[model samples]
Target: MPDQVTPPPSMHWIVPFAASLSEPCQHALPRLADAKALPNLRRLLGQLQEVARIEGDEYALSMPHERVLAASMGWPDVDGQLPWAAWWAAQDGVKLTADAHWGLLSPGHWLMGRDHLTLLDPATLALSETESRALFEAVRDLFESDGWALIWGASQRWYASHPSLQGLPTASLDRVIGRNPDVWLTDHPQARTLRRLQSEVQMLLYQHPINDTREQAGLATVNSFWLSGCGPVPACTATPAHIQLVNALRAPMLADDMPAWLDAWAQVDNTVLKQALQAVDAGKAIALTLCGERHAVTLATAPAPGLGGRMWQSVKRLTSSRSGPDPVALLNSL
Candidate 1:
């Protein structure tokens, strides 16, 4: 058998945005005066953060950080990365410092620069509330037309001003952004699209029938599974558990064996396996490769960074821990 393997269905780049503002809404008490408006916004932002974090953790690559976004896109950063000191020195009346800004945030989304398109102007505070509201609707329409979802603000109760969400589930148009009372939210097309897309991505992973045709054509490839964890799986993401599961596999598997592997996983811990599968299917992973009997999954199409000694340490921990059966010891016995 060949030792090297070819790539499979690859992962798409996940563009990230910092809703620094979102943190407040996520942690805020939902029973406030605007309780109805709070739940959806919270849900949407939490989901986006989850998506970004999982992608980053699984790939061993950081997503677009705030500093990267600001510097790359010619935007300002709060960390004085924008040469604002030089600008202030050159111009006598430039009173804008990072601390005093209101409408715009430093280190915004990467798309603000590279996307060659503008969705919404965080800096459009100068517009009258009504004019700003209209502009926001236009931006929302632009995003929907292009198939990008605004994952951050989806949950905020808002009404539709743009025509893009004419057929989608929507909140009343009366809900408004507090800063721009004139700008009303339509059905939060961005957030809606994101959820739908995440669900679709998961379906592609969990429900994909084996591509027996592709395999029979002799175009398919697979490898033995392996896992390496640096620390106890963080509660924040999926890499730890997914890697552990792969490491725990006693033998190689065919691509068609994924359902059986999942069944075996349920025997260990049903809830963890289920949630882990859902998140991995949705976010970082795109496909599994079939070896003879066991499947080797790829986080993306890219080969993973070689595992280090920490992975061995994790295996040791797995063998010694009491939380579940000793998968390492079991695999060793096999």
Candidate 2:
């Protein structure tokens, strides 16, 4: 007869994008500032502090979302040059050309603020597949005319290929949304040419039929495109099989919509975190990594200790003058 014993629970990894749970500006929003708003999140943090162990050295400050994804795929330290466009294109079944650089071309609105221009969140564009393809067709010649190849992938995400863009470092879209674009533009030697291309594309799309239709509908016009993740395919090591990511909060966080951010957090807490807790209770190994704008905190299920080990830990705790770092404090620090 086969063995009747069940295997121990496998380790699971959870990554929540843009929790930025304790924003300084949130103090102004009463609903957001209330500790009662995200009960499950707070509960999860408390449980981790009491039962799980924290790995403080894993924190990454001011880290880009793409860098996290890259690291999860075993490609850490690629930072600003992760070649996300190539990865996305491959995921969409698009073949790449030899020695060509690929970039994500997202249609977005650039709002003219009192002092500077802000790139509004791309999600607000509400661009449909047909509309995206039409816009891509309208501007395809502009890129081809400039010796660059343009391919329409998914809605609001087109891929462009250019030889000059190879090895060019571009900021991730997450880093620039709802902020000034000038700061994130590449300072590489070939940036001038890329800037000129951007200008020409903007000019061409200024009065296109699509923009006219959008304007007639009182929607934000798709006046410009953001080119990022520009580079050749990056070499990566082994990719993890089970790294779960929750990013519903990204759009709201970038748009500075506090209520939406809180709602998204609630959903994650109720669904993802709740499930993780149950798994942990069932003797399953699990890990949670909370990421904010500046840092990330990871907590994993603590290993079981024997009676002797427990006694030793208790004695050590009684003799120690200092306490371990507070998980809540660490989260707020992020």
Task: Score residue 187 of candidate 1 by CA lDDT.
Answer: 33
Q: Against the hidden reference, what TM-scores do the models get?
A: 0.18, 0.81
User: Measured by C-alpha RMSD in angstroms, how accurate is candidate 1?
Assistant: 24.0
How much lDDT does each candidate structure score?
Answer: 0.25, 0.67
lDDT of 1 at 96: 28
108-157: candidate 2 lDDT, tens digit per residue: 88887899989988888899888888888988988898898888888868
lDDT for 228 in candidate 1 is 9
* Candidate 1 weakest ten by summed lDDT: 222-231
Task: Summarize candidate 1's per-residue lDDT along 1-334 as a digit string, tens digits.
Answer: 3453423323222112111122332232121224232232222222222111211121111122322322333443332123222222223232322322111111111122342422222221232344323333433444446553321111111111222322222211111111121122223454354345323433332322322332355532110000001011111221112222222222111112333433433343344333333443343433321111111112232223246644664565467423322222211111
